[model samples]
Target: CLTASSNTDGATVVVEPCTTNNAAQTWVQNGQTLLVFGNKCLDVTNGVTNTNGVKMQIWTCTPGQGDAAQHWSITSTKTIQWAGQTECLDLSGGRLTSGNQIQVWLCENGNANQVWNLV
Candidate 1:
């Protein structure tokens, strides 16, 4: 589950086991961005840098603002990539444990850390 640390802007986005009736785990895909807490969009921290290992977070939704950092799409290969960027959402250190924060790193073919499946 992609969870927000809190129902507020600038909340850390982490992976947690999907649970019933958990609002934090509920995400809504609005266009190319994922939204949590109703108005926060999943964003890449300092996304303009496009640096490897930058953590993901929830920020105020900037719909139709052409903010590449907030634009995301799941590719045919099951990897989530940001608009016009080569980086994809990655599992930090490739760990599968809960509470693992997601990051953005260079997209690599066959990299399990970058793969995601919509449930």
Candidate 2:
């Protein structure tokens, strides 16, 4: 069960376990399209190419897609890696300060601030 933040600056986003009775947890893949929650699609902001604490958001799934935010590829280890960059989604430098934003940055092993669990 991987939990993604709702936004780089918002609350935690939990990926509920996919159970036989929960279709929302089921991920539908068609080529590059990822059908999340059967409706909402994960997206990044615009097509920005920076890995320094960029914002992440969600929107209605589209056909052709929009930006790198919408482009995510899951690794064999089940880690969610952003497409445009090799950076993995990470917490804000382990500051834990209020309003700390999340960003995609280079994977640095099991850094607590970088280590994320798929719920």
Candidate 3:
């Protein structure tokens, strides 16, 4: 599961083995807006543009509505992508093991590592 790893700002998000009480992994959202924290937010570095292998991180929240890095879109097939970017959230090295880091990469048609189930 996607987890916050910590409550601090600029924390690394990683795939951890799922648990029943995953408060650190829980998120409140409205549309594409994902609130990882109150003022700090999730981004592909908050404003950094489209680039492969960019590590997703928590940054001080952007002040306006969603942008490419700040907003996420999940296609019908469950492909989660950064808004306006060709890249989708990817498991580094396409690894599925615990503690694997997540990044943004060009969406592959049927990558098991790129397919995410939010529940």
TM-scores, each model vs. reference: 0.90, 0.56, 0.84
TM-score of 3: 0.84
Per-residue lDDT tens digits for candidate 1, residues 57-112, read: 88898857437789988899999998788999899998878889989999999999
* Candidate 2 regions with alpha-carbon error over 4 angstroms: 1-37, 64-67, 95-101
Poorly placed runs, candidate 3 (over 4 Å): 37-40, 64-67
As a whole number from 0 to 100, the lDDT of residue 104 in candidate 3 is: 84
- Residue 95, candidate 1: alpha-carbon lDDT: 84
Cand. 1 Cα-lDDT: 0.84
Report the lDDT tens digits of candidate 3 across residue range 1-119.
88776777678778888788777677666577666656545678545665788887766556785555678888877888777778887889977688777788888889887898877
Go through the candidates in order and give each one's C-alpha lDDT.
0.84, 0.54, 0.74
What is the C-alpha lDDT profile of model 2 across 3-93, one tens digit per residue? 3344232233343333564544445554454555655565555536655666544566666753445667666655567775767656666
Structure candidate 3, residue pairs in collision: none
User: What is every candidate's alpha-carbon RMSD to the true fold?
Assistant: 1.6, 5.5, 2.0
**Could you give me the TM-score of model 1 versus the true structure?**
0.90
The number of the candidate with the highest lDDT is: 1
Clash number by candidate, in order: 0, 8, 0
